[model samples]
Target: MRQTRLRPPRLKAGDGVTVVSPSWRGGEVFPQRAARGAADLTARTGLRVSISSVKPGLCPESRAGRAEEFNRAVQDPATRAILWMIGGLTASELLPLIDYEAFGARPKVLCGYSDATVLHHALYARTGATTFYGPALLSQFAENGGTPELTMDSFAELTMRGWTGRFPTASEVIEEFVDWADDSRPRRAVPALPRKALRPGLAQGPLLAGCVPSALQLLGTPWLPDYRGHVLAFEFTDDNGYGPGQAARDLWQLRHAGLLDGVEGLVLGRPRGWSDAQREQLERIVLDVCHGTAFPIVTEFEFGHTDPVLTLPTGVPVELDNTTLTLLEPSVR
Candidate 1:
């Protein structure tokens, strides 16, 4: 019972974008980062940016207010795309008030991740609107002076124009995370190990994933987009009172629900904010799950909450092999 895929229109230069806060308004908390992000989106990406929620205050005040702003942006003809500000644990609370019909009637590029993952799943399942698992306003694009080249490049490809190519190689990863304080603390760098093929083989299907912990919250909910026949990807981010055991359990939940019955491949994003012991334990859990299948598994991708991450188009077709993943179709156009 898969819905026909919905792809948003590719953006062009000067197209107006509305930065909506479907969750916490990170911009409100960090005004400097917020201003820098808005200005950078125009200066760096060449897109005309406007505001929906980045105001003179933190905390959106009410769920109804956030939903109203989001729906208004969707219905606005001038706004071609809507970018999320930042993800929070309470995104699901806004789901009830979202105008899904309006979203279905006019699909536009909706980009975000982490807590924004909830909105992506709900929109795709309820209205079949394709969404981007990419950067947000105050978090990714507004990083200090600017974001990394890798982040900017991939984001342009996925959001501004449709891309049909391999994921651009990430030379290194920023593993050292500094708590976001005033005046900006930067993400520290580490050498990126070459991606390893886990249980190598080949598989082709629509791509669907998010930070597994965020994704797990949608389990058993109608808003959880169907994962069947999709190349499933998962990663660890914003540890919500969980660890490797919880990660493994979430994977088992999918298997238990028979959601993975039609899946043929898997990808694991690089472990950010995790130790060697934790990563090892997590890998053991993954290997145990894949013991019987050569399902074209690959790990250590630069996505999730890690810095210099790739902007992935959810619900798009992709081909996976031992060494690489290639998009079979354009994500935006």
Candidate 2:
């Protein structure tokens, strides 16, 4: 791991935010909706936003454009935080082009998920700067009506107010989904389902991890951060559900790479839209990897690729209590 510098504080009302596409660039297709989301973000929090140059590009997947835009946005003195428009499979391509030293000197909240995980790990490993695993501009902000209150609240706690506290484990389970694209669905607050604890015990360490495959893709690369003494977290989208054999293979790769050797604990989010069999298989794989290890493991905490997801801060101290199965930490400075 690289030596980390002091991180920039969370954003506040009237502060400036920059939206950039460091991986995939589909912002141009929905410029109007994207603009509305940005406006809503500003209005909801009283923060100002500047759309990065990459937002209006022809091909956001192009490595040259992404690297140039990322460098410019992070270097801009006025930009308090950077938001990714979408997570692309090609974010790793920008790694060679990224100036990690520059980011280390001026650390800010770099946020995104999925493919953005590559950048998050790269930034933290190369520069020792903290980042966030949360919703993206289009994923969370660009809803037809507005951002979900739960997402908004989590974002505020993690990014602005810095209210890092133990995430509330659901006492009673309730599950529901709103098609933000559908105007007919009433937007209402729904209770989060109770979090299931895969193993029993409390564990504490710096929070790390992201989309499973994305993190796995970086295993052999020099950019992958050293997860020693860290709490590893992972979640997967509906598109690529890992089976028993697949999950075992992935964990084997991490083990072979020495990634999980010193990991203090594991926090597995409920895989969204995964079958019961797949979930069971994943749970077994997790157990096998941690077998004989002294670290506590907690599974099925609600975060990542799911509604009502909790936002986690990378590189922050976190405590997981097995009795409650909650990941606790301060959201910000």
Cα lDDT tens digits for candidate 1, 152-226: 888888877788878866878776655666545666677887788867888888888687767777888888887
Q: Which candidate is the best by TM-score?
A: 1
Ten-residue stretch with the least lDDT total in model 1: 53-62
Q: List model 2 lDDT by residue over 1-333, tens digit each.
A: 332334568789988889988766767766776787798788888878777875465355578888889988888888888888878778888889987887888888777888888989988887777788987887677665577666777887778887756675533222345444453543444444455567777777788869777898777788989888888887765454455676677677777778878777788776655557777778788888777777777776756766556677788777777734333544445
Off by over 4 Å in 2: 1-5, 55-60, 170-192, 240-245, 323-332
Q: After superposition, how far is residue 77 of candidate 2 from its true place, in Å?
A: 0.7
TM-score of every candidate relative to the true structure: 0.92, 0.87
- Displacement of residue 199 (Cα, Å) in model 1 is 1.1
**For residue 199, what is the lDDT in candidate 2?**
75
Provide the lowest-lDDT 10-residue window in model 2. Answer: 170-179
Off by over 4 Å in 1: 1-5, 54-59, 184-186, 240-242
Give model 1 RMSD, 1 decimal. Answer: 2.4
Q: Which candidate is the best by lDDT?
A: 1
